[model samples]
Target: MPDRIEQAKRALRADLRERRQIVSSQTRDAAEAGIKEQLDALVDRLGARSISCFLSTPTEPGTHAFVTAAVARGIRVLLPITREDGLLDWSVATPETEIAEGLFGLPEPVGDVLGPIAVNDVDLLVIPAAAVDRHGMRLGWGRGYFDKTLGSMEKCPPVYAVIFDSEFVDDVPRDVHDQPVTGVVTPTRTIALASHHA
Candidate 1:
């Protein structure tokens, strides 16, 4: 059953990736503008003084503006640094922070490596996802890095997955290790999940 489910996830990931690749830069920029505005509102609603977030790649829903803007507003921001052992380290992200290519070709912060427990300090977490289901189950990249991180948290903050407007769907494959998010922030709306664990 797990194998079949994982196979389905692989197929879905391929499809989503292809869809993202075909989006014009202009459309993506427009979507990102809306997303940034929505994220700012979410932060205020949650009173999230500290946030853990990912630096998005070009093809993903752009988080570049949101991260920088949040930092400028004096919100404490932490960005992940992929480690070789599949665990993620974190570092404080400022507009001036130096970045370098890290694992999985992600732009990682270059400075002191705050270990995984750094996540416990955040009031909210905004993670990257390929897609999110109506139930808030997030389909992440196959690496399981975020899954492992969430699984280890004893008292997680409100975790939200950031996805494009079209990526929210009716269902996504689930495994025992998969953690559902509290909500999804799309370009057009913020959908709070009934299945939110925290």
Candidate 2:
């Protein structure tokens, strides 16, 4: 299963890079707008208070529109930092917050590290994935950061994996360490209440 997942991840990564290369700036702009609309609707429905999400790195799908919308709604927005052991820790983000490069070249908050908060403290968690199945199982970039972090959470938040529509699948190889999401959101729609416990 791990080998299969690795192959799938490689394929998906190549596909994404190729697609990004050919994608016109105009198309990307339009996609960003569509994604914003879907995410805004999902955020409203979820009614999250304190939310933990990722800042978009170039290869990822999300537009960061959800983060902006959350801030606009006065929800406490948090970002993840890759810890030394490949685990993730959360820190708060405000409009004026400064970010610095962290592991894997991801930008994270530069202010005082607030450390990990209880998962239950977060009403919603916008998760990043390379691909996700209808069953809510997610395939990340083969780093167990999210799995480790989610496992340590006392109370799991409502997890939502963000992906491009084409990246949503009917099945994906899962392992004991793989963390599942509660739902998935794409540019066109949000599939609600998808259980990851299958």
- The deviation in Å at residue 184 for candidate 1 is 0.5
All candidates: CA RMSD (Å): 0.9, 2.3
Candidate 2 lowest-lDDT run of ten:
111-120
* CA displacement after TM-score superposition, residue 6 of candidate 1 (Å): 1.0
Q: Which candidate number would show the highest lDDT if scored against the true structure? A: 1
Per-model CA lDDT versus the true structure: 0.91, 0.74
lDDT by residue (59-145, candidate 2, tens digit) is 556556667777777989888888887767777777777878888788777765766654448877887887788778887777778
Model 1 segments more than 4 A misplaced: none
Candidate 1 per-residue C-alpha lDDT over 44-92 given as tens digits, one digit per residue, 9 for 90 to 100: 9999999998988889888888999999999999999998898999999
Give RMSD (Å) of candidate 2 vs. truth: 2.3
In TM-score terms, candidate 2 sits at: 0.87
